[model samples]
Target: MEQRVDRVEQRQDRLEDIVATMGELLIETREMVVEMRRENRQTRRIWIAIARKQELFDDDEFQDVFGDE
Candidate 1:
């Protein structure tokens, strides 16, 4: 009976350790997801700016910038 109790206690300790590790992993994953989202927004803004610049350069007033057709 005493040996059985000791085994149960050990199992509980192991489970507690696993839960703590999982919690830490979850927090890290959440932070990584947030960072990725921020990077995606920054990338989109850069692309939009580049597209606008391209449009400006395509206008008739800026045609000389590209030389003959």
Candidate 2:
């Protein structure tokens, strides 16, 4: 009976450890997701700027500003 109790305690300790580790991993994953979203926003802004530049190049007034590239 005592050995059975001891085995149960050991299993409980291991389960607790697993849960704690999983919690830590969850937090890290959340932080990484936020960082990725920030990077995605920065990339989107760069794309928008590039598109605007392309539109300007197609405009007739482009020559008035830069005077022939």
Candidate 3:
């Protein structure tokens, strides 16, 4: 009976550790996704600015392609 209780307690402790680790991973994954989205937005803005500077499209055409900034 004592051995069974010890085994159960050990398992409970291990499960707690695994849950904590998973929570940390979930938070880290969310942060990474946020950072990636921010970087993508910045990259898109830079490309649009370059295209406009190079006059890749006329005003109306640019509007049609990219919409209003």
Report the lDDT tens digits of candidate 3 across residue range 16-53.
99999999999999999999999999998998899989
lDDT of 2 by residue, 1-69 (tens): 999999999999999999999999999999999999999989867765675678856556655554534
How accurate locally is residue 45 in candidate 1, as Cα lDDT from 0 to 100? 71
Write one digit per residue (lDDT tens) for candidate 1, span 35-64: 999999898677656755778665564445
Point out the higher-scoring one by lDDT: 2 or 3: 3
Worst 10 residues of 2 by lDDT: 60-69
| lDDT ranking, high to low | 3, 2, 1
Q: What is the TM-score of each candidate against the true structure?
A: 0.77, 0.79, 0.82
Better of 1 and 3 by TM-score: 3
Q: Between candidates 1 and 2, which one is better according to TM-score?
A: 2
- lDDT for 26 (candidate 1): 100
